[model samples]
Target chain A: GAGVSQSPSNKVTEKGKDVELRCDPISGHTALYWYRQSLGQGLEFLIYFQGNSAPDKSGLPSDRFSAERTGGSVSTLTIQRTQQEDSAVYLCASSFSSHSEEQYFGPGTRLTVT
Target chain B: AQTVTQSQPEMSVQEAETVTLSCTYDTSENNYYLFWYKQPPSRQMILVIRQEAYKQQNATENRFSVNFQKAAKSFSLKISDSQLGDTAMYFCAFMKHNTNDMRFGAGTRLTVKP
Candidate 1:
């Protein structure tokens, strides 16, 4: 694809429900990342995956937040028992390779936990 | 631990004028990367510019340039000949040279008034 793509551009779910956000990175991108952004707030790093392996999961806010990348091309972020605090825009980005290069971002998925 | 900071919460610039957005970061690692990303109303994060810590010369792209002072840990973006299209939230980000974790600072909202 031309750039990173994300599914379910907007999602509204009841509190406590589980939601999954998907990201399809560029054709050859090997580094995938997830981030959360609140209204008028800065982006918070969630997790990073490199080549189907996540070497750093330290940014996951809680046990309910988890992510996995398969084939080093596609990734998914799952939020279990979503809370109102989880209502925000979830972003996905991928770079050609990790090595401090530029990252192309997706049209983030806006998740609203009602 | 690496942390990025953008102290200016908001800034306004007139068309054709110039404005500088301030950013500072703290890190124990000497080799890393710094970046500036812009997010408009459309909600897509776009890379503005990047700088390698080892590079002494500042990075520049058209009207956008960075003043990077490694000793003072300051990386500021100077937007010369500003345009209304430049109005958006600008973020400062840091990434370790060998790691996948890209830490971002609280963004500075830049409004380029016509």
Candidate 2:
């Protein structure tokens, strides 16, 4: 089966620029999550979505960061006016459901803000 | 808020041998979940094992097993008959029961030498 896939495997952008990372979850997966991994730091939860329910956006760092899942399948994480601190590998994962199911992760999109 | 900790930054194990990785977490929530995820050079995070907080019994996969200590908030992974393919970055994660919020720890880099 095809796994979760992310677009723009590597991206380089200037500071203050906006960037969008896309994620295509597995077929029929109702739960999707986004995380960021900084150098030498742990994976940081960014956002989560389950079906049509309101997303768990508490983990999003600031207003500049936002994510949306359209059609309950593909998702996009947008960072407006990116900063150097926002440089990290953005990982997307999907699970069978939000109820104690294992998550499968994408290869991740490495974002570099210069 | 919950935090997962992986004490060992790096570890080396001989092929076909057994190795154990340590993981500890801090959480005030009584009901949660623990997971071990492996990320290879391709940087695809793969589920290794998972343990439920309410369950006393440890979880096990083919070559992987977990020692879940609820009182101590410890969840360690034991890899038996390690193979060269086992070399990767391992991450420990925690998820609360009511939410899709998942927290991951700084990874442990495992090197399996033949």
Candidate 3:
């Protein structure tokens, strides 16, 4: 079975430019989440989507950060007007459902805002 | 709000020896799940082990196991006969029973040397 996968493993962009990171969750996974890992820091919750229910957006650090899951399988995290502080590893994870304890994670996309 | 803590920033263990990584979390929810995830230099987050808060017995997977203290809010991971491949950044995570929101602690960097 295929595990979660992400595209553009490394991305370098200008500070003010917008970047979109993609995630392909494991087939049959209905719960998807996005998290940020900064240097010397823990993973910070970003956003989550469960099936077709409304996504949890509370974890978004600011209005510039947003994410969307399309057709309940693929997700994209878009950062608008990125800042140097946004330079970090973007990790995506998915679970069988919201109640599933073990979530499968993908190889993260490292974004560097230059 | 839930929070996970890993006090040890780094640890080293000799190959074939045993090592323990401590983790503590603060949460009001009575039922939840605790997880240990390993992230190597490849940036892929892998689930090492998991424990259900409602279960009294600890969970074990091969040489990896957990010491889950539900009352004390502590969940420690123990690795026996540690191998060089076990060297990685280990993170402790918390997730309430029925939600997609999960929290992670600042990781502990483990080095297994021969």
True contacts kept of each: 0.89, 0.70, 0.83
Please report how far candidate 3 places residue B98 from its true position, in Å: 1.3
What residue pairs are clashing in model 1?
none
Candidate 3 is graded, for docking, as high
The DockQ scores of all candidates, in the order shown, are: 0.82, 0.73, 0.82
Candidate RMSDs in order: 1.2, 1.5, 1.1
Q: Estimate each model's TM-score.
A: 0.96, 0.94, 0.97
In terms of lDDT, the poorest run of 10 residues in model 1 chain A is: A49-58
Task: Compose the digit string of candidate 2's lDDT tens values, residues A5-110.
Answer: 9999999999999999999999999999999999767788889999999999988999999999999999999999999999999999999899767889999999
Q: lDDT per residue, candidate 3, A1-114, as tens digits?
A: 489999899999999999999999999989998999998788998998999999989889999998988999999999999999999999999988887458899999999999
Kindly report the docking quality category of candidate 1.
high
In model 2, the Cα lDDT at residue B42 comes to: 89
Model 2 chain A poorest 10 in a row by lDDT: A37-46
Give the lowest summed-lDDT range of ten residues in model 1 chain B: B97-106
Which candidate do you rate higher for TM-score, 1 or 2? Answer: 1
Q: Rate the local accuracy (lDDT) of all candidates.
A: 0.93, 0.93, 0.93
lDDT of 2 by residue, B1-114 (tens): 788899999999999999999999998999999999999888899999888898898999999999998989999999999999999999999999866778888999999999
lDDT of 3 by residue, B1-114 (tens): 899999999999999999999999999999898999999999899999989898999999999999999989999999999999999999999988877778899999999999
